[model samples]
Target: MLTATKMFMIVFTLLSIIKSVTLSACDEQEILDISDGELLPNGDVVFDGVVYENRDYFINNVTGIKTACPKLVINKCCPFGTGYKTRQCVNITDSFDAPVWDRYKLIEGARAREMFRFRIGKINCTRPYARVLVSQIGQLDWSDNWHLKSDGKLFVELDSSIPPWTVQPPDKYCIDTFVYEDQDGKTHTRLDALACFLDETPPNHFEVRSTCMLLSCAFILITVAVYAWLPELRNMHGRVLMAYLLCLFVGFILMASMQIMLTIDNITPHICVVLTIVIYFALESAFFWLNVMSFDIWWTFSGKGGMTSKKMSKRFCAYSLYAFGVPTILTIILTSLEFSGLPPHPLLPMVRYQGCFLFGRSKLLYLYGPMFFLCLANIVFFIMTALRIARIKHETEMLKSKESAMHDQHRKDKQRLLLYLKLFTVMGINWILEVISALYPDADYIWCFTDVYNVLIGVTIFIIFVCKRKIFRLIKKRIKENFTNSKNNSEELKYKRTIPTRLCEDSQHQRGSVETIRTTIGMENGVTAEANTTIL
Candidate 1:
């Protein structure tokens, strides 16, 4: 009896040792040195030839057991702390690959819980019951709001309005599809058609948005052209206006092109990223230029000495430095954060990670934040200039409209201030609408109204600046000059054709001498110095 008992003890000890070795071998081979690993469908993570059962399992077990902690990380990890990574919105033809679906089958039964809050992407669901059909996890109603329980289970309340297809709710979390094999080795499948992979926006939505943006871009180009073509408009003020409009034009065109490409399924991820940076830079530069205009107006009315042509040129160079330099720095910062591999945060402009453009908090903080401050500054400048103008008026009441040269300049400056005010108001309204739309995305009517207003922005600007009486007179003047020059050319050709070569040459010499004599006399009479102060 004693011998038999001793033999049993030895066998039991051997079995325990073998079991520990077997478990340790699996751990050593498959659970060590996992960094930046990707989560698999079967509640496992695989990277660098190593695997862990789930994100939690990797985190919990890899401590002290491996030199490095096992981590499940993915790129574009925006909408952080939401327990998911958001991908760029894609079109119908850009759905998950067949291989992805094949691996998706592994997420059955308890494995579903591993992907509890995995986000695929946002969808523009047209169907009334689209959300209900897309979600299968816990038979929960589709909601942006998510809840996590202490036991690591995800729970969502059901909406009674959504009719239930199954009598019993699902015990596990799964979306789009659920596949499993029973003890009998029979595969059971439950599939729901999620419209997420379909066209994200309505077909007409892109067309309308793109058309409005393109229209705006065309008007912006026209505005720039007007400034470029007219010497009167090519002064310090005109240069600033042209620069601002050109930046606005670039932003609008690039944005419209990106949307059109998305609609046609022609844009690649890389191109989307590049266009996003360019658009951001252009838009920011435009705002800076607008700010420069406000500052210049304030400075003009600040009782400073009048500017000469050389001084005006130097000041314009300074304005260009501020307007262009700041946006370049901002763009560099945005690009650096994108490529720096830094952990996701609310402050960073994760342009590449989130989507093609700024969204959510990033949009508000980066795009609107600077604009809000600049607009505020513009208002302050306008107020200060108005106060200074009032003071000047009080002092010059006796000389009201008496000094033609000084009064004319003051009138021109006042006109410029009014023009700036109109432009500021228009842009300010646009910014406000953008903020509202972003904050309350479900307000479809607001989106529609914003789109209509976008089209009217360019129209309104054209009316405010280009459609003025003064602008019309300038246009007429330019046309008359061109016509007169053409007529003179024709007259000269006729004179040359009718006359002999020798006689024509002699007449040309005499005419040149006579013109020089007349120009000399004119200079002698009209040599008065006129103040050429440029109102930027």
Candidate 2:
């Protein structure tokens, strides 16, 4: 009663059953039994679970198969231990229903089983067989920095000592490889299982940082605006301060936006690299402008005749060139090195490889290196200026000259220098913390402090400059002068209007009298001698 299809199905089932039975037998005893120490036809010997390279390379003769052999034969055994070998060459016959991970298909499946076993309270540290070799990715190698914490979580500490590229988060998942060993203490080279690192940061980390940065940027803009609006703050020193604050504002805003974009995954690698370059340029320019301020202060006290140089405009131009030009050159060098196709090194500014912003060695070398020199130079300038100031003070006191305009000008310069010093100290401390955070990224307390400090930078500058009693007095005077001038202008305008009206009336009356006189003269001429006598 069976049709052709029915007969074919029955035949296929019988063949599959036979194949399964044969494979099961192979699984139980993979090698054919022979005399001890006997070599196979291919000149290889199977000893225990491992196949020796040659007849002489047996269990007794083998010293360290883990390191001595390059290629390893994977065996079906417990998952965890010291010497678990890769299953890259093993055929998948188990019905564990594992997902595929390219070359790690079998390894991933085994890892799933291991994880399941662990979650089900199957982890036993007491027994050698109880330990499981669990890793998610086979391609990744283990590092000494990777450690198992007491809470059973894998923790990796990435410091400046390690190359950043090595610790870069993988696109798919994280990995941790483990070596497995048998009860006899022989280490087996196991295929490393791959799992992803929990790359999730604190939930509000980016949001809070970006918020603080933006708040600082707003204060910076306010500071710049205040300086620009008040003429008293529009002098040479004020101009330099404004320039520095503007550059800092630009850097902060762009950096905050970049972080926000990164947090939302809205930015691409190309954009990230571009933004980083721009941010670097802005921050560098800001630092250079700060240096310019320091040098200018030093020059003022250094008895440099050029402090009142014939062309103050030319002096500003020179400062602009130094501040802007150097950053441009540095940026060009950074861009060139990035595209030069050089092999990845610790010093190379691998902006694109980092996904967003510079970090680790690249940041330390590129961002911090020049800044370090600039800061050092600034410190030197400050010291020299301080010495010059002390000398000037002593000379003035020795001269016994009354408070002249020159003395007052010197006093103002000293005050400006103090302001610059304060600014330098603030920024110097801020960047020092930044460097420390970059070196030890795991230090959460440092990061928190830096975030709070970032918010204070602009506010502190504003307080130092615009909130002074002298500045307030100048603002009040400027406002009062403006008001008084407007009042005078209104009164003068009314008086001029009254004078014009009165003069017009007087001129009209005079014209009428002249017309009357002309009429009388004409009548006199007509009447002649006879009419003149009658009128008299």
Per-prediction tally of clashes: 0, 29
Candidate with the greatest TM-score versus the true structure: 2
Query: What tens-digit string does per-residue lDDT give for candidate 2 at 261-294?
Result: 8677677777878898999999999999999998
Question: Over the stretch 274-342, how does candidate 1's per-residue lDDT look in tens digits?
Answer: 998899999999999999999999999886887899998999999999999999998888888877887
TM-score of each: 0.61, 0.64
Give candidate 2's root-mean-square deviation (CA, Å): 16.6
Q: Total clashes, candidate 2? A: 29
Tell me the lDDT of candidate 2.
0.66
- Spell out the clash pairs found in candidate 1: none
TM-score of predicted structure 1 = 0.61
Candidate 2 wrong stretches, greater than 4 Å? 1-192, 196-204, 306-310, 396-402, 488-514, 527-536
